[model samples]
Target: MAMTQTQRFGIFAALALVMAATRIHHSTLHHFDALPDASWGVFFLAGFWLRGAARWAFPLLMAEAVLIDYVVITHLGIDFWSHYCVSAGYWFLIPSYGALWLGGSWLAKHQVGLRLSTLALAVVALLVSESLCYLISNGSFYWISANVPAPRSFAAWFENLGDWYLPFLQTTALYVGLGAVLHVLAVQVARLAQHRGQTQH
Candidate 1:
């Protein structure tokens, strides 16, 4: 189903809020340490629901992510470039997040309905996209970032990947899964309302 302009705006606003709220703590603040960043899931869902708005929306979200990081890092009285996460590898986030967006876009294009098949397809898409994103981000950080010492190797990189992969994957899956549930519930509610209106008429 094509989303109306109002629906698009609503989704955009919601995604922006989620990115800001979650990332504020993600970057530096330990106060909200329990809340993992929703960036990966946000980009994925944006691609699914706001595919038509990609020309502008994708860039907007990317800007928002950077802006959020800038604000948080600066607020802490630290120089942005000097921050540990700010490295040559940081630029790779464009392609990393793009991988997620494309995955969701692929699923949206191929999705038939809310069936088991659709669920299976979504799972496959999520796994593929997340893996690719992780590879780009994690591999770049390990191999290219100055933060890692000069003695990096495939053996060490593989071990480093293992250490962080599960946490990132689990956090992303949690948000995306919750989004899926909300989507299902919203669809059912809309259908019920429409059916009641028809019956009344």
Candidate 2:
């Protein structure tokens, strides 16, 4: 059965807020940390969790992200945008995130699940989706608007991909996989309780 809108929003809204808090406290440095930003995972889950009008959750979460950045830059006196928002490439996030949403949506459309085959298919879809998102996002920034040195080459861009893309995939997988596990556990617990109550009757 299709998921209800409230259930979808409840899951995503809580996750989005938590991730936004981490993003808020995040520094400009590139060092990895225990609470690496969860936007990538959050959006991936959004596509998985939301369908129909509930898909509106994407833009809502996007807005929350923007608001987080706004508070960080304006209220907190951080120049986050200046560092990355130097060109038209920044706006490509719409399509980048769209690809993420599409990835999860495609998984649901095909009835992918927790099993090995479905999980494998999901990984492939996620890889393709995130790869495309990375290309558009990093590619636009590097080739279009970024202040890359004159005479940029594929070698240099590949280095950037190394810095950003793999970490993104890893961070997203870590969190989303954990969430999937918890979800399965909760379903099992609920089912077990139901069985116990029925036996008692």
Candidate 3:
């Protein structure tokens, strides 16, 4: 049984709201919460359930992320460039997230075992997604201030990389762990819905 376009939209919209709300509290408190954020799940499910519609859904997801972060930055009085840094990071990471989601969604079809697979996907996502964030913000830092770090010594470069990458790695790990759980749940719900639909017919 195939999911209808309306069904896909409803699923994606609901997931987006979940993503937004869950992140809001954590971001406001400057705390990285362990709740599952649905942004990547939305993008993944949107692609799996909606196909071509995912093109629009992915960008809209990114836009929503930027808007939410912007509001938080304003409320927190963080530098505006920080907002830009995050937005750019999300922009860079979206494709990696999308690909991860797509891969997981594909695995779902085969009833591929969940726990180990989910962890693997989450790890892959954490690595690439966080790395992208580090790269984007590192570039931004360099652009804003030259001589930020010299590659003259291995320790110097390592410290510079750590300054940019460590926080992102922690955040991504937390976010992706929750996301993996949510992805598993979403697939289950969709399966139940499909089963029910078949019964109704």
Candidate 4:
């Protein structure tokens, strides 16, 4: 979809806000747990909604993610570089997240409106992209990061991948599912308004 500059900025701001709010800290609010990090979903939705802004939007979001992580880690009195999650492998997130963006972009290019076929395509795209992303991020950490002890083997890596894959997949799916629902609602409302205008005419 062709979005005006204003629309692009608005969507960018909203996605940035969601990422900031959810990425800052994992905590409970009024007996309810906070939402999981929305970084993965943000990139996917940004690709779908602001495909034209990929040149700048993607880098900005990546920077935001790093900044948030730095702040959170430093606040806890830990050195950023020495942190468990920060390593040479951490740089692999570029390709990891790029996978998601590409998936969403492909879906946006092929989608023909709200239909089961479109939904099916979206699910497939998300699964393939997420799997690739997990491999890049998880594999990099397992093989390159000092965080994982020596004696690394494919069997061990595969076991590690199995241990964390579902939670990450579920989190991404939850946010993407919400985004899909909102997209449907917005499209339906626009169609309804247009229909009413035509009927009045």
Candidate 5:
């Protein structure tokens, strides 16, 4: 039988919870080190599975991020609400994700795609998302903190962009690759489970 939306949602929700728990545990044990970009699997699945509702996908992902950020920030003595508000800018990453997925889908449908091409696209998409995130974060910090230096003009914005751009690119690419591998493994596991269930029946 085909899965119902509610069933699918429940499955995704459970997966998200598991991912979140694992992230917290690992972060704690290893001094807040990111285990993997498991959350990107959530984004990729949203694109491939629920492409039509991509906007909603971002909000949901951001909500999870907000929850996680809140815990981390509070533990570090930062104000929860302010951090949540700042983190809201992460929603911008969705458009970058959509662009990548859509481009890849289009290429695949045309049967003119290479595995490396899609992987490169994923990396570029992550970089774009990270750049956008840097802008969002810098702006938020400027807005919230009076002591923070203002990017008052185009040059300042450019400078700010340069400052975080490389780090963002590196980390985003790393996470995107990690996320892609996780997504592939997940698809394999799901297919295997389905096959086993069919055999049992």
Candidate 6:
């Protein structure tokens, strides 16, 4: 069944909000929060669900993220993005996040797969999108950083790449994958209900 735009946004936005709540308590990479963030999933789902309006999806999602992080810091007492380093290269998130939406939109445009085949396509898209996001977000921030010491070695600064990147991938994959499963289940249930109603008539 075809989903209305409102419903599509509702499902993805709800998931992003709920899953991100877990991260808000201690969401930063340094915090070691085990719960996966729905951030990537939000953009991915936006690309898949937003249909033709993907141009505005990144900004919208970015706004939502900023608002959530502010609330997390002020209300929940978390330290994510606490320093001024964020402002130096933060706008790069526009492209980084847009990569995610672009990936998912590509999948939808290709019509990827309705069966389990979507898993492969989704993973490929996920990897490309997240990898770029990580590079842009981290690289730009680190290089432009006013907090880190001067004359830092690339090896020293980039040493934490694996530590941060791996978990980020894990979290993003966990939420996006689970969200996809839930979406499929929802469609199945709806079809079943419609089938039942038809039989009753």
Predicted model with the maximum TM-score: 1
What stretches of model 5 exceed 4 Å from their correct place? 1-50, 53-56, 75-78, 81-114, 143-147, 150-153, 184-201
Model 4 alpha-carbon miss at residue 136, Å: 0.4
Candidate 3 runs further than 4 Å off: 1-3, 22-52, 74-122, 144-157, 164-167, 185-201
Candidate with the larger lDDT of 1 and 4: 1
**Backbone N/Cα/C clashes per model:** 0, 0, 0, 0, 0, 0
- Per-residue lDDT tens digits for candidate 5, residues 1-201, read 134678557645754675586555432222224544344334444444344444554467556755775687678787764543344444444454444445333332333223677666655544454455456555554454544455466676677668766654554455445545765686677789989999999
Alpha carbon lDDT at 63, candidate 5? 68
In angstroms, how far off is 31's CA in candidate 1?
Answer: 10
Cα distance off (Å), candidate 2, residue 117: 1.8
The best candidate in terms of lDDT: 1
Clashing pairs in 4: none
TM-score of 1: 0.95
Overall local distance difference test of candidate 3:
0.57
> What TM-score does model 2 achieve against the real structure?
0.84
The Cα error of candidate 4 at residue 5, in Å, is: 1.7
lDDT of 4: 0.85
CA displacement after TM-score superposition, residue 74 of candidate 2 (Å)? 2.3
- The digit string of per-residue lDDT tens for model 1 on 100-184 reads 9998889999998789999999999999999999999899877888989988899999998898888878877888898889888
- Candidate 5 all-Cα RMSD: 6.1
What lDDT tens digits, residue by residue, belong to model 2 across residues 120-168? 8778878888888888888887888756666888999898888887787
lDDT of 4 by residue, 20-99 (tens): 99988741111114578887888888888877689999999889988988888888898998888888998998999999
> Residue 77 error for model 6, in Å?
9.0
Alpha carbon lDDT at 46, candidate 1: 85
What is the lDDT of every predicted structure here? 0.87, 0.73, 0.57, 0.85, 0.52, 0.71
